[model samples]
Target: MLKREDSAVSKPEIQKVGKYDVKEELGHGAMAVVYRGYDPFINREVAIKITDTDRGNDKDSAAHRRRLFFNEARIAAMLDHPNIIHVHDAGIEGSYCYLVMEYVKGAKTLKEFNKKNEILPVEKVIEIIFKCCKALDYAHSMGVVHRDIKPSNIMMTSDMDVKIGDFSIAQIISAEVTQIGGIIGSPKYMSPEQVKEEEITSQTDLFSLGSVMYELLAHVVPFDSENVSSLVFKIVNETPLPVSHYNKDIPEELEQIVQKAMAKDPRNRYPRGLDFAADLSKVYRNLKRPVVDIKEQAKFEQMKKLNFFRGFFDSELTEVIRAGAWEQYGVGEHIITEGDIDDSFYVIISGDVLVKKGDKAIVALKPGDCFGEMGYLAKTQRTADIVSLTPVSLIKVSGTLIEKMTVHCQLRFNRIFLRTLIARLSKTSEELAKYRPL
Candidate 1:
């Protein structure tokens, strides 16, 4: 009763597949048809991916498609990450082979967001890709390499959580390719190494993720050509126009991350998934502007008064103020919590603040004095807590915005940053001299 009356969708639709009762067709692709199915044993719904090699294809092509189906089952079994689709069952009944996975109701592929009108907001894109990086990290930890990381393979549930599927071309890192053979991944998403038909590593997945990010933000693939040969050559030899070229509003830091992930040489890419995720986290935290209400002119006036910003022209200072977050904090509030991951350079506009490590107060800072210099320069976690000694107002500048400033403005900040570092080092030297004997 579960078998089809005819291999074609003609001759009265057949019903079940093994023990599961097929409901309705969800969607279909070249080699598979997905169905909304019910598993009576578990009383739960599932998505059944049934291999569909039509009567026209040769045996070789059909065999390859079947291998991909079973290979996905094997790969999915090794992965239990939240961001990956969970495979429930895989079976061969009569002439049919099918794989079942957790059904995400109203699930949609990221390909839906690739259009210009459908592009996601910048922060939302960052969050989605950040989750993807975490998933890849977990899979790579298990020695699995997802050879194909394309937009269509990434699913977004109704609730907005991401799930990466289609591990059909994925391979075990240390094993020989026995089932799914050849360079069989979407050309637009392939890395340089993949285009060259060379062995690849986890970094290839990162490259593919970068390609996906490019398309999501810019609404165009990084590399596209008229034919496969031209595309492969471009993947290996050409550089895409900067993402900012397409969407001027994309953050500079995000564009840099995209370039690095898609670097031609694998060695130049993020060494680990953790490393890639870390940078994305940084971008998410600092690049997003805080919602606030402050007159731009008033903020610019406050910034120009600071001795640190004396060299900036009125226009340059205006640009800096517009880029930074101007906010006020209550007395005794933590301005920068110790061990918090942030790279915001702050300048006290009014009131005083104190720097501390544990129970010890390191120093006191006043209006016109800037803090977070080392943290901003080093791009790491805060080493000490900066607490408002009194009700305070300050401007917090993120590194992402700084890159977009004028050359003169950037150079001035750099010079003042160096001067601050030198002054601190000098004070430390003076204190050390007290311990020295003549």
Candidate 2:
């Protein structure tokens, strides 16, 4: 946490709390201001969350709030998991109750990430949500329900590790503390039971997790409302557009897991967070196959959309299409090999292929991209292995066909082919430059 006081004289300059010195304000929430601070006792940096005293008057009212705040901290501190932020210390200093927590560097809220890239890849979305499921499962086993689970509460590091934060609304599932008929959580992510003010269970968290996963995959909330009343009504009554509806690329197995996790009836949903995680793991395995087919005509149309293929005449393209043979590959199948004695070129028709040096992918080829053309032109062995990342469809053109076309077709077609080959080589060179050493 970093804390910095405003230059305005009216505001209080944040003072040192015990052995920790406040640096600059990291963020502000409804009840507290989080700051970056250096802990002299530990000889390391940590985040300090300080409650604002301005919100309440009198010592008794302040004391009650402090007790409630520390109570939440005490519950959080008891749980130890890698995905959960560790709480170091919590105490009252003067009028403010402050909590010292682990300092995670280079983290961004999922909301901030979505504002920049509206949608993320399905693989990445699944990976993050799976981690959240495991963390939530661990918390649930300890009789804790994170009442609020949303994009804003999820922090993702640069390496793609996910941490669920802001446990202010977390409810202990003990019968003595469980509050009936009390709605507590963000409405957008609220489970049907939560909206109805029913008993909060582990299932409630699963529903919220589903909503977060839905937003991550689709880039839209599962339920939308013009007002709070309508929002609550929808949460209890409505079913969102299937994850596949927004992004057809999402596999059926994944879509099914999300749908089941978000079921309107708690009984119909995943019984525990582990169940949800297990389903997601299955989806991860299924994601290796093609989600949908890419027809030959669709492949051609996609190719025409590529920038590298600009200004290519239909007559020239027709010859290439005539010589090409469509081939389907299973996931992990090798379409070509490095140093293989084959003079065949290929163009991606559907799915994804990886050009690799041995086992490592040097480049990924989506629809419209061409590969092995340079080798075909030089009449030499492949420089890299082309392996299918997903179940793939490619248009393979043999060297013999190209030689025949060169002999039979006019020189204009040959000139066009040479130019197209050069254009593809230029694009590949530019892509390879990104991985080159500085």
Candidate 3:
């Protein structure tokens, strides 16, 4: 969870691991100690989590700890996201196994702001949690579920960027690994299903995130009792006091988000992190804090006006709206980064963008122009960067979700996408033919 220790129990009595030099103990828990280390090759500081070799002679405990330790390395390293901690490397050096992770220079645990006197402004909470939802959505799309998603597992940078850390107990759900069941999670933030050791999914993390959000807003956990058993009972069988009950200043729309997130039934909770983020984005607007005033219906209308959706029916457009996000960015903002592995097709619904490779402008895109054609068809990396040339509004659609649309809708959409790609190729050929010395 990237949790730091108040005091060191003992040092590892070592100077280095591979090319990294151990500086000091950053924190220590029951199983491992996080040390501040320096990577000589890259010339940067990193957090080294070294698992204890001698927890006990108990093989099961040691095995479980080792598995969990490596699990974080294997899973977190694969997740290349800004909001998720990046795992650089992992290896075994004699008896000690360790992970090299990004050292977030100056950040505070979400725990610090959950106190009654330390609550952040409502707008900031919406911004912070919105990023978390997007991050978790990305993780869920990749088949990783952070089983423990409490406040301590989430970090906020000095600039207010959110990072979800400590995937040590995260489970990889896939076709082969159908379900996971274990009474394994932080009790205070555990969902009803978690306490019961029911099959875990992305919803479980959403429920935990709800508890964190509740604590942040109301200055109290949704369900709490000094008595452990009573707390578990409350989480499983009771409805939490409405968030507005504790903090009347909290908006009803925001409270509903917390309520839906913490719903006792997984089915009642947000179907996906994308849905969670969409609602929060709406609440952000209701608070009158949106950068642009595009509501859902307005966004739908914008899409309808786009030549990209000319032949699609309103019902089909509604499905498209549900399957995508309407986002806004200021001028000079980088809409797409070169070399990033993303599969989101973007349509400029308003304003313009400059598509550049490095510093050279390859082309300029206007409203109704589309990009990510290849990405829409596969999990490919971007070759050019798309930067906003003006205040920009975009509809970002993930390839994964687009596949779930109706067959007729897909056919129409693909036909148009193919046309756009072919037209671009033809234009390039004509330009190249002019340079040929026949």
Q: Say which candidate scores most in TM-score.
A: 3
Which digits, one per residue and each the tens of the lDDT, describe model 1 over residues 1-438? 555545454222437888899998887777777889999999999999887544344787767777887788889889998889999999976546789999999988999988666779998899899889889988998988898999999999997889999898898887766746578889999999888889889999999999999999889999999999999999999999999999999888899999999999999999877677767866786665444578887887777777877777888888777667777888998888887755569989999999999999999999999999777688677899999989999988866567557888888888999999999999999999999999
Off by over 4 Å in 2: 1-12, 53-64, 116-118, 175-181, 288-438
**Candidate 3 versus the native: TM-score?**
0.70
Per-residue lDDT over 1-438 for candidate 2, one digit per residue giving the tens place of the 0 to 100 score: 323354422223585876789887788766677888899877988988888553445566455556557656867786888788788888776666788988878787888756545467887787788778878988998988888898888988776678888776687777376332367668999998898887789899899989988988887899998899999988888889998888878878888899999999999999878777766654553463332444557656765775435566666566666665666889998888787654567777678998899767687888867778766677676788888999887777655455445443435434546877777789989988999999
- The root-mean-square deviation over C-alpha atoms between each candidate and the true structure, in angstroms, is 12.8, 16.6, 6.6
Off by over 4 Å in 1: 5-14, 53-57, 176-179, 289-438
Worst 10 residues of 3 by lDDT: 1-10
lDDT of every predicted structure (CA atoms)? 0.84, 0.75, 0.82
* Candidate 1 residue 25 C-alpha distance from true site, Å: 1.3
Please, what is the TM-score per model? 0.67, 0.63, 0.70
- Kindly list the per-residue Cα lDDT of model 3 for residues 189-302, writing each as its tens digit: 998888887788899989998888888888877887888789889999999889888888888889889999999999999988878877776666557424344577987888
Clashes of 1: 0
Residue 213 C-alpha lDDT in model 2? 89
Whose TM-score is higher: candidate 1's or candidate 2's? 1
Q: Which should have the higher lDDT, number 1 or number 2? A: 1
- Deviation in angstroms for 165 in model 2? 1.5
